[model samples]
Target: MNFISFLLFSALYTCLASRLGDRTLPELSASGITTLITTPDPIKNVDPSNPASHLSKILIPRVSDTENNTIVRDYIVSTLKALQWHVEIDEFTDKTPIGTKRFRNIIATKDPTASRRVILAAHYDSKYSATYPDDQFVGATDSAAPCAMMLDVAEALNPLLDERKKRLDEGLEDDEDVADTTLQLVFFDGEEAFVVWTATDSIYGARHLADKWASTYLSPHGKRRLMGTQSTELTGIEHLILLDLLGAPQPSLRSYFLDTAWLFDALVSVERRLGESGAFAYGEEQGMAPEKWTTYFQPRTELKINMGYIGDDHVPFLERGVPVLHLIADPFPPVWHTLKDDATALDIPTMRRWNLMLRVLMSEYLHLRPEDAQPHSAVRRDASEL
Candidate 1:
């Protein structure tokens, strides 16, 4: 991600943020949050020391257009596919500063038949380096941990999503419109520029995907979001929550858009509940214990437009009028873009907290009942029906 002067584009972003309608997410029950956190073993996938973990698999020099990029893309695809998600690979070639290169963005939806979707996304590709050792930059906090946390959210909530589907099918769901919205995870490729950050050089996959979705018209049957008007894939999105620069300790996050401020506050609520419940107290990280943990989100003061915006994959989507919640570290970790951004830069307790936070946040966002989900089952299918 790159930084731009907030003064240069504050008005433009404020206008875009206002285009989004207000959204209210149901809060998960204490037991539900506990079930979601404990069942999936929140620390498993994000643990860098575990060779079989998702982070370990993704912690490599996966520069876009390279073999490592393909490997990481395939890994993400297979993981989502194992959970029976509808996965689509947006493959294309675009001109870069260096030359034309191939980019594939992974789009995984829990229920492709849903009318609308809320996206959780992060970039899977690492920064490109010209030298050998420099090329080994893994981008652990840059995005690898965020990607892993996305996977963890999927695993933790898959059963609850199934239960929600069952309720909807049985006509027992409270709100059909809310139940119609599904979860979609997007792993954007080429988010990192080949050279310095430039409008054309950065976020190649996002720019392409956003443009494609904007133009790809959906049939009237699925255009229920816009009062029977013709809608495109982009219009079917309720909100796009983009995660970046996570997995590091002591990092601060802020609400970048007025439209998603409620959603950001919703996430802060999840963290607060989990912290007070002692869920973040992992091993020796006593500071994260109940009443001792610090907040990742800064306090929201005046209810005004944001002062600036960060240049990331969400830019194209937000410019196209998508409600965006950009959850990126404000200060950029101390190891930003350096060779030191390997596994050493990631803190397990921090990643675990992120995992739990996503599980509860998404569970509440989707109105899923994690209380109905059981732990350790192959797919939580053996649990009592919702």
Candidate 2:
């Protein structure tokens, strides 16, 4: 009640408030703030044909073939591990038309500490045709090239990701709550149907993984939280970008969802810039026009056209409310699901263009800086960053 007592209480309250504010609003390190560089200039000199360059190593009879599944799985696992990524296998058995079949989803992450993720996915399975049981279909453009392209992107971004991880480990970055934007690569098995294209027959790995992720939760202490906890949310996935039928010549890619149209346009812009830099000229020998390198979903005319829904590996994620950017050819390549869809179906020039476009798009998305200037900073945790 005395004046001295009142002054003491006031001083204590002020000190407590100051400490709480310091804890909540800690000063961010300079390394934590990302600097946006010039957009899609194609200044970096990279091999244009790198995306399809791995086809020879990956092109196989059928990903679903019992004898070839392990080989394909081993290739994927070893490729990711060689890039220093943390890889995990999601193995499960599913009931199919033929019988009980085992499927595996190879999940790779660059940063394990980051809660939010950008998923780059492709199905590694080739279709099975009962009519041509003895035929060996390579499905090069259908999915083999797409899977290889995903690996190319992962390999390109590995250095930046490793640097960010180092900064986090050394305490050079002060962000604990909001880590950098991390990349998650998913190689789904059984995307192709054993019989007919039914809801249950295809995308077995994607369906299982999506369900599992939706039910899983992380606690504040980094432990597995209960599924029904009120505070739990789907914090792992931010955006899902699915690549398919990407190695065909003069392929057309259109924006699938209204939400991810901006991303599609971004890719178009990247293609245009790369064209200006003569990147697409590499395709001239193969009869691809450099002027037509842009994506099919141009804002002025093509934006209004709806290409309808596609049933790829992203279906389960999209159905569960996760944003998806389906990077598949609109009309389905001519050789799709045919015996002719082998290594010869892939166009080297088209693969080159796709490789450059993907590199620029990913660098822009992750705010990657030049290796000589400074190590790329972690993406800020703000919504605008997404």
TM-score on alpha carbons, each prediction = 0.93, 0.76
Model 2 C-alpha lDDT per residue in residues 1-386, reported as the tens digit of each score: 00011111222122212211211122122232112122222222122334323565567765564667676777777767766678999899999998898888889988765656778889887777676558777788778888877776776666656666677778876654335468888988889888887889888999999888867756654532222343223445656899888787777766656556667767777666666545566523624355644454435245343334667888777666666778888677888888888767877667766766676677666555434235432221211222
Query: How much is the lDDT of residue 206 in candidate 1?
Result: 99
Error of 1 at 147 (Å): 0.5
Error of 1 at 360 (Å): 0.4
Which residue segments of model 1 deviate by more than 4 Å?
7-20, 303-305, 376-386
Could you give the C-alpha RMSD of every candidate to the true structure, in order shown?
4.0, 14.6
The alpha-carbon lDDT assigned to residue 176 of candidate 2 equals 49
- Best candidate per lDDT, number? 1
Full-model lDDT for every candidate? 0.85, 0.64
**Best by the TM-score measure:** 1
Segments in model 2 whose C-alpha atoms lie over 4 Å from true places: 1-53, 131-133, 167-178, 221-234, 283-307, 371-386
User: Candidate 1 on 8-67: residue-level lDDT in tens?
Assistant: 344444333454466677877777777878887888899999988889889999999888
- What does candidate 2 score on TM? 0.76
lDDT of 2 at 180: 46
TM-score of 1: 0.93
